[model samples]
Target: MSKAKKSEFRPNDYVVYPAHGVGQIVSIEKQEVAGFELELFVISFEKDKMTLRVPTNRATEIGMRGLSSPDVVSQAMKTLKGKAKVKRAMWSRRAQEYEQKINSGDLIAIAEVVRDLHRSDDQREQSYSERQLYEAALERLTREMAAVAGGDEITAAKQLDEVLLSRAA
Candidate 1:
């Protein structure tokens, strides 16, 4: 294992894999692959019902990171309460941007997607694509929130929804 990744992450830690949301590092495995011995971090995603083994050396390069600190989560919640910035671009372009933000593994960016796509009681319903993107962003944000705050995803999601809905009112 590289010196950098040797102590960067540990088993039982909650990490955010850019494309996979939150997952737990179950263990570190040393295995021979293609005639070379490799050290891997085995991550399990309960929500996705999947397991991912990432080479320890490549974890940082691929944006595998620890959960956001409480301060950062607070900032993201503040972002959720802020005004939504709807762009004048086409849905395809906007969707691409939202996906990029969500995959950036930044809690505040994901929160922005949730804030903008969130529909208020008086607002028109979201289109199918918009709803999909919104749900994706919400899931990513809430999962991180739950991991950081030490509770379940459902409670975390409800707390975020309360923040958004209260702001709308």
Candidate 2:
């Protein structure tokens, strides 16, 4: 690898880790490991109360990405307003797919999960697992939305609720 280090992210930048949703890059750290210098990004997930250290060289390789752009956010919101698509696959298979989508860290994919799994008041009740998946997806979607809009999760959630409720009508 060339000694030229071109980093696209800096401290305090919000980024999404595929498996961990959104986290802020608190700092960039350089440590010596096995007689070699390694650079890492120190990320903090406030909502999950977790911190992660990922090698800077592996950020993009591991699907760590910056927050969604405004257009992407709008596209995700449009996805929420669309009809839900629940396949006829078995529940277990569908559950696994939903989990995969949640962890993919793709805003639109997460939005689809939230839209499909959402159960309005009059809709049939959801099972325990279903509710868990929905909440997980919702949380991921909400966090990214909030980060993009520079608002709190609660406000983002309310905006999402309005969109979903309008879709149901």
TM-score of each: 0.95, 0.95
**Poorest lDDT segment (10 consecutive residues) of candidate 2:** 1-10
lDDT of 2 by residue, 1-169 (tens): 4343537889999999999999999999999999999999999999889999999998988889999999999999999999899899999999999999999999999999999998889999899999999999999999999999999999999999999999999
Clashing pairs in 2: none
In model 1, what lDDT does residue 146 have?
A: 92
- Report lDDT (CA) for all predictions: 0.93, 0.93
lDDT of 2 at 58: 85
lDDT of 1: 0.93
Give me the overall lDDT of model 2: 0.93
Error of 2 at 169 (Å): 1.0
